[model samples]
Target: MLLNLYGIYGNFPLGKNDMIDNATQFGAAVASARKALGLTQRELALAINSGERFIVDLEAGKPTAQLGKALAAAKVVGLRLTATGTPQA
Candidate 1:
């Protein structure tokens, strides 16, 4: 339930759709959350039943990484993504 207002990613205000604009931002957030939880990439991968390479790519912000696995990793690390309707102008 960490909400970083200054951009470490959790619950920060985003663009119109509230979606992260790029993989680098997403990856940094994931890495930050993982570290905050004191879990190593390999440990998180094992906990989430994913491969170490997947974790590496995820932390590196690989744009084409599988959404399912990425979401799963985020969950294990306590990161939550939500969707909202387009913001009003």
Candidate 2:
């Protein structure tokens, strides 16, 4: 298990009130999804038409720097994006 920080985990089943933390959950989710599918960061990045560095950033939950690209990459990795809270109807 790769632990990024004191509270951050690098893989699935999230943890302790998980998604409540932040987009880190989303990023970690994407990374976990990709790994489960048996793909490397370089492969995922290529599939997303992005650079490995960007994918690394996204997986690291540093998305505040590039959200659109991160989401695009996430989509390429076959992960669906949805609003956590209630969407305005």
Candidate 3:
């Protein structure tokens, strides 16, 4: 199912930390996608051979220290990263 929703609907929290906010937003996105697919955090974490906290952090939008882990988690949660200079449709 294709779900179109803004992960960041309101103001970016109270703090003005864009980097942290970015990570949090990213995590929220993963969390949302997982919920949309009806997958528990543990289930998703196990599927990706990771810890629940890791998923929690990711869903919380924590900028991963390592890109590989982030990518792996994203893949496990059916998330993909695409780069496009053009405006999205």
Each model's RMSD to truth, in Å? 6.5, 7.8, 8.9
Instruction: Give one digit per residue, the lDDT tens place, for model 2 in 1-89.
Output: 12221123324444433343456766787787678667899998887677898888788887474777776766665555434555455
TM-score of each: 0.72, 0.65, 0.62
Reference-based lDDT, residue 11, model 2 = 46
What does candidate 3's lDDT look like per residue over 2-82, in tens digits?
Answer: 222232222222122222225665677667667766789898888878788888777766675356766676565556554
Order of the predicted models by TM-score, top scorer first = 1, 2, 3
Worst 10 residues of 3 by lDDT: 11-20
Candidate 1, pairs of clashing residues: none
Residue-level error in angstroms, candidate 1, position 35:
0.4
In the range 1-89, model 1's lDDT, one tens digit per residue, is: 22221223444333322346567677777777788777899999998898899999988989999989987887777676765456556
How far does residue 55 in candidate 1 sit from its true spot (Å)? 0.6
Candidate 2 Cα errors over 4 Å, as ranges:
1-21, 84-89
Global local distance difference test of model 3: 0.59
**What is candidate 3's CA lDDT for residue 41?**
88
